[model samples]
Target: MIVRHDAGRRPGYPAAAAVFAVGMAGTTLPTPLYGLYRQELGFSELMVTVVFAVYAVGVITVLLLAGNYSDRVGRRPVLLTGLAFSAVSAVCFLAEGGLPLLFAGRLLSGFSAGLFSGAATAAVLELAPAERKTRAGFAAAAANMGGLGCGPLLAGILAQYAPRPLSLPFLVHLALLVVACVLVLLLPETVEDPERWPRLSPQGVVVPSEARAVFVPSALAAFAGFSLLGLFTAVAPAFVSGPLGVTNLAVSGAAVFSVFLGSTAGQSLTERLGARRALPCGCFVLVAGLAMVGASLAVELLPLLVAGAVCGGLGQGLAFRAALTSVAAAAPAEHRGGTISTFFVVAYTGISLPVVGVGALTVALGLRGAGLTFTACVAVVAACTGTYLLRRPLPERNRE
Candidate 1:
């Protein structure tokens, strides 16, 4: 086996993970406050999802075009640039006047996330101690989910109790980004060569022929899983306030947080049950959760909605982590990054496109009808995916 010389000696792993968490947190900070934007701006539900989709567009563009930039120019530089984008994104929100500003903020946030997904993850892994690889993986995953969970939580608390719901969260995020930048500067450079910057071009989805069999199922599972996340992040609050009659911003934020928190908890379960078991198991739970959500929409019950969020979030976490593990192990080392990028591209598509469909359906179907329709469709897809995985489980040798 190949060994890394500085594996156990590096001190930047924790710092990099912290920075990663902060940046990811910034991307979702506006989630709970979308309703306020709607109230002030007089925009439609379709516009909400359209704005969210724009962020995904920015992320996919960056992943395709500059995903490997850190591999050449060095992690610190790329991360700093990402942080800069984060700062600009915050400024966009802070200066928001109309739809254009909101769109700008979200797009910049997407750019920041695309950069973090590659450079920060690589930096965290590189800085980790060799024997602590498993722990590092957990750290990175937790930082991602935990940070995402914290965003709406923080924004909700601030929006409900603090002044300027639209303004405070971004301001707080800007401060955190500044701190993250300083920490990044202090971390030792992980990349060995800084002079070998290659001519950059879009490296769109690169799937090696050998990995196709497992990749299809993995990508499908990811797509289904991320759609659950998309639903909660994009419009769960609207569901909460509009149909369920819950008007507290903190409660709305908490609802969103619960899904992500459940996801984080589900990810930990992967270690116990293994990815093979976790992948299908997650889909089943997700389907059940969707069922609950559909019922809640029909009956207008907040408790059922909350219950669904927890259960579905857990399922998503479990399946998402398993999918990542399975795909990573199956991929050729040289092509791993691109393969994973493709997986995320599918996942992000799930997050964007389906939610936008929900937005479109809302015009004719109304919120309850739109919600019921959304849940039914996603549940069916998840059920089908789960059944397929159960029927053709990954080979025993490949599972961890």
Candidate 2:
């Protein structure tokens, strides 16, 4: 097992980040397959959102209850536990017979993400060489957006061209999970206390006192940005396959991947533009992307849809990384994990609630109309956030 010696040597940060990426990839593996599930199970669009929402619920629950578990136990143990959840999630998908199993699978995946969001991020940062701490930020963002982008691409390709579409995707993911687990075993543990394990108890989202000022704008930006992501992740496949008549899962997945790929690219650029500037700019760009998405839905243009995905995803990456960096930097050292957890709790809420609203809206007014409504709502939020940030600028020096 890879263990870190506290003798001023850096642990294997790249390997740890890779493990984080693989684990995250498993979380979104079902993005393109939702259409298949709807056809096979005979469920409504609302049901799809509900199923997706369950994953967020699981993530929030874990963050609230177990977000700081790694600090007490150790990063490796919590990460391994998260991988176990990922394996179980893959199994649930592989064995899914009905909605219950689907919910279970998503819930398990959410739990895995919740555990990972805190533990893996901290591990990557801790493992970084002192000189590379700044780069560690990009590494974490890349692992996250890159992993998320790859999930849909992988599942889409398999489901489109391979036999046993649903089953094959899960099988491939399970194999990857096994590899990730092995990698986790080889990752150096960063937490100092091995015997200081605290009994797990529900600690509702721990927002830091010092971070309160930065948290508002940062979390708002994240909320708006994530709402855009939620739109694509939950319903884009249905729009492509149902309304637009694009039936290929691989194509659908590629479309989804475009947005996340853009997000990864946007994250890479955050270093050039400071966090403060990146936050509002991301919101504005996100609004532009949403406009393109709305236009695509109205005209049924595939290219427009792709553009929207890429643009919106880029905006999300910029805003999200900036928000995370600011929040983490402002948070007190002792409460860093808890504060980050709190930020994610809000971010995940953005991911879940708005998507659920869109799903519900779809029931009354078809996908196109519902999408328009979503676009309108998020645009308002993004505009408000951008305006607020501009009117009241926070200290740029807060960036670490």
Candidate 3:
């Protein structure tokens, strides 16, 4: 077995992380190009958001249904299957058949992401030697964020500079998927024949009474943070192109990248701040970012918009980590898995449901007005979450 070929455990985590990153990067590879699709297809902004929401639907569906499938089979099989789905998604994009293909590609991308979310992360942690498990955890998180951040950036640069903007991004992703499959083949099998992976089924999120105090605030903070991320991921590109008149696809992608980069940077801060401090601190920072976004929409400034993306992303990263940490710590051991799943469901809902609202709002309010409205609403939610956390901090035992 790959795990016991030598005296020391193979440093398979790096490869596993690479595989994880590649899988997630495919999910967002289309962000910068939504404008192209809009122009080519003559679709409304609401359809754009609907296309994006389709991905989240696929993700949440798989998370609820097949989250434990990887455990039942083996990590490698699930990882490979995820990669296969990613490859299919790339093919769907490459087809460029219009809305139907676009939706299919995104939905397939979501399935790949959902599979990676549980399987790839667990694989990364398990591949590491016991001594390196902590580092492995960091790798898993970074791979996820880094992959997501890189997707738009890569697609943007390629689409802007390279020939065949839509086709090239998926072409490149398909090639990467090949490398990911090879890596997965080489990695050690983390799940034994008789493993007990978390059994996450169609059951709704279960927040036991004992965990409610921490769960309420933390989940709210996550909801708000994820909502900010959703806004950017779904519509920031259009906002950049429509109001700001920035035609460069690279610029749009960069704007989206900044937010995720900020989020990744913020998550690192949680390590130092601990759960008690980070949750409230992240909320306030997120509020600041949301206000900046509102101001940017009002004034129509590209730089301000970018800055807001990064700041809000940072706050999201911070609160997300702290919230997950606190919620997990608060839950009774037997019920922890279900509670965590519930937390993610809330978070993903924030990512999907609000973006659709913004899409619908765009019909009545102009893009700028709709964005302003969104920023105000999300900002208030974030601010309230922060204030609540400050007034009633998590227990000291819940500290990082």
Which candidate leads the pack in TM-score? 1
Output the lDDT of residue 16, model 3: 91
Estimate, for each residue in 1-400, the C-alpha lDDT of model 1 and write its tens digit: 1223273434558888999999999988999899999999999999999998888898898998988888778888999989999999999999977999999999999999899988888888878878877778878888888888888989999999999899999999899999999999887777775645667767789889888877888888888888888898899999999999999999988998888889888998898899889899999999988999889899999999999999998889988988888888888998988888888899899989999999999999988999999999999899998999999998675589
Off by over 4 Å in 2: 1-11, 208-210, 332-335
Candidate order by lDDT, highest to lowest?
A: 3, 1, 2
lDDT by residue for model 2 (57-146), tens: 999999989877887788889999999999999998998779999999999999999998888987888888778887886788789888
> Which residue pairs clash within candidate 2?
none
The estimated TM-scores of all candidates read 0.95, 0.94, 0.95
Q: Write the per-residue lDDT of candidate 3 for residues 1-400, one digit (tens) a residue.
A: 1232221354388999999999999999999999999889999999999999898888888877876677677788889989999999999999989999999999998889988998898888877778887788778888998899889999999999999998999999999999888888877776666345446456456899999999989989999998888888889999999988898999988998999899888988898999899999999999999999989988889999999988999999999999999999999988887788788878888988999999999999989999999999998999998998888889998998
lDDT of 3: 0.88
Question: How do the candidates rank by TM-score, highest first?
Answer: 1, 3, 2
Candidate 1 backbone collisions, by pair: none
Clashing pairs in 3: 262-314, 263-313
Per candidate, the number of residue pairs that clash is: 0, 0, 2
